[model samples]
Target: MARGHWLDPLARKVLQAMGELPPEPSARPTPAAPPEPPSWVVDVNRASASQWRQLPGCSEAMVDLLLRLQRGGVQFSQAEDLIQLLDLPPELAERWRPHLVIHWYGDAPPQPPAPPLDLNAAAPERLTAALLWPADRLQRLIQERRRRPFDNLADLQERLCLPPEVVEQLIGRVRFGERRPGPSLPPGC
Candidate 1:
């Protein structure tokens, strides 16, 4: 009987000359890494505001924006599409893209052509059409907008003298981007 070499391949070969197990299968091919799951897949049309909030790196404000877009018949076909349409910050968008997916719905009804209204820019008619505000209030808003553009959601509220509760109610119902008569301008512009 003979002891076997555990370390040296040559020694193992020598042992094999006498009779021993074949040299360990040449370094096992490195096992391929497992495929990653599509963890970021989000059903844009179906996800609730809360669900949207659950996406990695998403804030409450981001969720609101997403829901508003969804309500406006803006269907997200891909992460890139959502990133471009939302005009998300490049770094933030890139960081979150891996976890996002625009889930498909089979035989879903066609989306409305109209997109959600931009709080900073929507026409009085579009505002009326999209929101349930009274004509008089909408008129005041349009007039106020002309005097000085809304600074942000807060500015819109302040300009309109809306209570905090009212603003809260309007959260997912409106967006604050692209001023009317100024497609390139948002709150600051």
Candidate 2:
């Protein structure tokens, strides 16, 4: 027998003695599997921020804003209402609105007849009320405003801790307010 072949048996014995060998029993118990994801019924008008994030194409930021708006008692008579609050593209809003399901807390209240918001002059409360932002979020936004004036609806959203989707949803609804005309003709002769 070759010297190298003779050493193989000794190596095997050494490995076995050291408890470095394979398992004695081939069968081993497997770990339990994880549970499946919950099937959530989305109520666009009432779903929490976290829940909104679950929707297809909805981002975490969007969900946050949506929840903030819902908590603030903002009404969604039509899904398009969200477009103004978030500053999203009209095409995008139309594309995503169908996936959203709006729910009324009770008998759907009669749509209030009100004029459009004046973004330049509206207070945070008015803005929040219009956008459906929760009280706490609205409060936070107001506090943030002391440091800097809001440049646009997006600026309000950034200060309000809103989700991107909610911001996107409101884009269409926001009215920047009509701009003042430039200096009149110096001399109308």
Candidate 3:
């Protein structure tokens, strides 16, 4: 056997007694297994822009887009849904997988369509046809509007001395708008 392969007499005796020899030590230490990522799970469905910004690779534009979509009643039910919504790269999505959590709170109720007629801006003839008001009442309404447009049903009712039943009926049929600017029409015009 070569001198390098030969073990010391005492060491060989110990190895023989132990039944095996330990492996030779290397010059460099063996590397340990990679550490797991820290848990920073965030519920994307309800996370604020700042929270979204806290993620490793999230961008300001992505946060803004998320907020806009949220405001428009969009809900993301999964990380994949968000990835698709923002068109995120697979690598970025994978990077975000451990930190992102999705929670779904059922879809928001639909909003009712706006009333077609604006009480503050409608013509007297239109008001007469829609509201079926007497000519005198319609004239009074126009005069009141000319002074200052009705802000809402309460304001309209108060200014015109309309009954509760009239205001109630106007609820879904009428809407008020900001007062129009410029010269007011002359009385009885």
Candidate 4:
């Protein structure tokens, strides 16, 4: 018998061994639906570790650090408060900022906005505000600058006293008021 002719009987025997075969055609192996994404809930003052972990793009380490900060009597008054904590990355802090809630303490007066620094004329406050460094770190940077002004962009990179990535970020955001005739001025000049 022809090879093609043998296929029909083989198919029949296989189907018969498996009990009654279907007369009509049927689709096989339906596709499964995609899983739903994790839901996010912003619980301002009382968010748990599990809740923090649910945030999109948050890592296990990041969530643990956030919970630790929360448990250490640190109340997040503003989204930017995360920057004050040393463990959290600036990028992750900024990303999760919108999800945080501010709980008003009793009789706390509305705080005024910090004055903007003149990157060209003013001190490290300009850089600190722009780069999100703590006060002590900012002071150290300012002290370093008082010794000598930065001669060029490379000098700024060398003496900025921040994480290299943060220095890069500051470099991007810094708006030089006017190009000094020669090179970039160092901090605190």
Candidate 5:
């Protein structure tokens, strides 16, 4: 069978001698596979705007629409509530259903209140931050307040040189003497 007749046996002997023969069984038992991880769920009601946009098939525009609904005093009780409130497309709703979840906290994120700032008690910084008034106008208001607290809306308008429209806007948050300032503007105001 020519010179190659002994080569196969020689090779097998070499492998056997070198302890490289066949696939050797392990000395120790194999470890069991690690347990599978728990699946993730996104709570629609509690998630922030950015988090909402991170869901499967979510879009920024859709998130903006949801935010608008939220700001407009809409409360979503569940994924269905969000779908209905947003008037989501049927196909889109189906796509989102797999990932959407709702863990209802005690309540939904509160809508900002009308008259969210108190003219009489709010600091210059609050007026600047909340009212978004220019510093000069805020300074004028501060100057006027130094003399006495605002007696009423008209007094504020007169002293602060506020326009009628601006006064209308401020009417919600402004308060006179004993009344407590509310946290938000009135709905539909």
Candidate 6:
């Protein structure tokens, strides 16, 4: 057959299979790669929950806390404040760092920190008001406290399987008193 003949394709395959010719490029075309998403940046002090949610790894609880603080007139002056306030993991904070910006409206005097609520001694009503926990979760907390006071945040988290954001919100707002022993049994049955 001539070089440009119809049998050339078959001959090329045969030669390639026998190692007499180099393999031909695939007849199928490679698909084009998908385009990357557009990058976004948000001002930490001014961003709404929806705006903040666009960033990777931001949870609904975190956004809720952020908006709550924002509504209370809290403003972030630096990246560290957002990371520290939200108790973000180092890796996650790093991932979000690039997308966060700070724009201070004006300097304000720092307010005195609120006294931490005692988890062991506080009444259920007070805890509910302070923690804003769901009714069932608050009930679990009260019940757990009645059984034995929590030693610390870690203990509470492990006992309740609390989400990291909840534990983080409790950091300076709640304190666990020293555990008290249970009542002694009667002298005799």
Scored by lDDT, the top model is 6
Which of the predicted structures, 1 or 2, would earn the higher lDDT when compared with the native? 1
All candidates: TM-score: 0.44, 0.40, 0.39, 0.31, 0.33, 0.40
Residue range with the least summed lDDT across 10 consecutive positions in model 1: 180-189
Off by over 4 Å in 1: 1-23, 104-189
- Badly placed stretches (over 4 Å) of model 3 are 1-37, 107-189
Sliding window of 10 residues with minimal summed lDDT for model 4:
167-176
Better of 3 and 6 by lDDT: 6
Per-model C-alpha lDDT, please?
A: 0.61, 0.57, 0.66, 0.50, 0.58, 0.71
Q: Count clashing residue pairs in model 2.
A: 28
Instruction: Report clashes for each candidate as comma-separated counts.
Output: 3, 28, 0, 1, 8, 0
How does candidate 1 score on lDDT?
0.61
Model 1 over residues 1-189: C-alpha lDDT tens digits?
Answer: 546445576776776566565544563367989978765565766778777776666778767766654544345444654554455788888766666656655444233233446766877777887777877778868887777666445556655666444554454455667554533333322
lDDT over C-alpha atoms for residue 1 of model 3: 46
> Which has the greatest TM-score?
1
lDDT of 6 by residue, 67-103 (tens): 7556545566568657765668999998888788878
lDDT tens digits by residue: candidate 2, 64-103: 6666555555546556566555556777776566556666
> What's the lDDT of the predicted structure labeled candidate 3?
0.66
What's the ranking of the predictions by lDDT, best on top?
6, 3, 1, 5, 2, 4
TM-score of 6: 0.40
Tens digit per residue, CA lDDT, model 4, 14-91: 775576653323324468988654345465446787777766576776666555434433344455433433235767
TM accuracy, model 2: 0.40
Clashing residue pairs found in predicted model 5: 113-184, 113-185, 114-184, 114-185, 114-186, 115-172, 115-173, 115-185
